[model samples]
Target: MYKKILLIMLCFLAAMACSSPSNPDNTNNGDIVNGGGSGNGGGSGNTGDGGSTGDGGNTDIPWTEIAPPLPVLDEEAIKYGIDISQEDSVIKEQIRTKIQQYNKDKGGYKVIFIGTPKSEYTQQSSLAKLVIDIAEELYKYKKYKYRNRY
Candidate 1:
């Protein structure tokens, strides 16, 4: 019985392998024609434009452009003059949470930061100030929404 089952399985595998697509390389179904083009048969070779051609005529599928992702504030350097060594962990956590929430709400595409001139930053700034500055910068791009809390 086991030998018979194995023989049947091998036959099924052979049938499946033979039943595979005639053209495994051509993935674009949009360019496939009904009766095939130039009598070359249905879906022959790549049409040079990364699209494949079918039998009778061109039936290319329409495609749409995807929207670009939003931008998020970067956390690389202390742009706002916040002394990391002197800052509290709780305050840092709060700032990080706010940035994360903003990124989640507005799909982050690339890293962004609010630039501060060296002359303007004379003293060490607070993390809360940094958050506010970042929010204001994002507001210019219509990506930020104030909720009375960061």
Candidate 2:
């Protein structure tokens, strides 16, 4: 029961963090941000252009097309009952397309990327704990209004 509750809470938090605000005209300009899990790169993945669109230094160019890839479930991820799948990429692409179309329809450069914190992404002993850490980091990012200090 505890695991189930945690899973549901994780789903809720992830969805809430990913979803756009209900009010399109919220103080934030429309920005479609993309953040990657820590990988081979060293930098914090910020482009650093300060275009005023708020897309973490990204330009108006929509991200390129990507065919859905196979799910690469690691033991840690599966043990936590997480659906680590490529379907999320497809969904994100669809959302990006819609946001781009919305920007065009509105005749404005509304879509922008709100930057993420530049802190190091560390892994925890378990996927659940890692997710909790990520959630807390995201909360801090917003609460402190973190910027790319690079």
* Per-prediction TM-score: 0.21, 0.18
Candidate 2, residues 56-124, lDDT tens digits: the string is 454645543322244535542233222323233433343344444544566542222222222332244
Best by TM-score: 1
Model-by-model lDDT, in order?
Answer: 0.47, 0.42
Candidate 2, residue 77: CA error in Å? Answer: 57
Q: Residue-wise lDDT of candidate 1 within 22-124, one digit each (tens)?
A: 6676544545443223334444443324233331233444222222254334444233223334334433444555566656766662223332212232233
**Runs off by more than 4 Å, candidate 2:** 20-58, 61-150
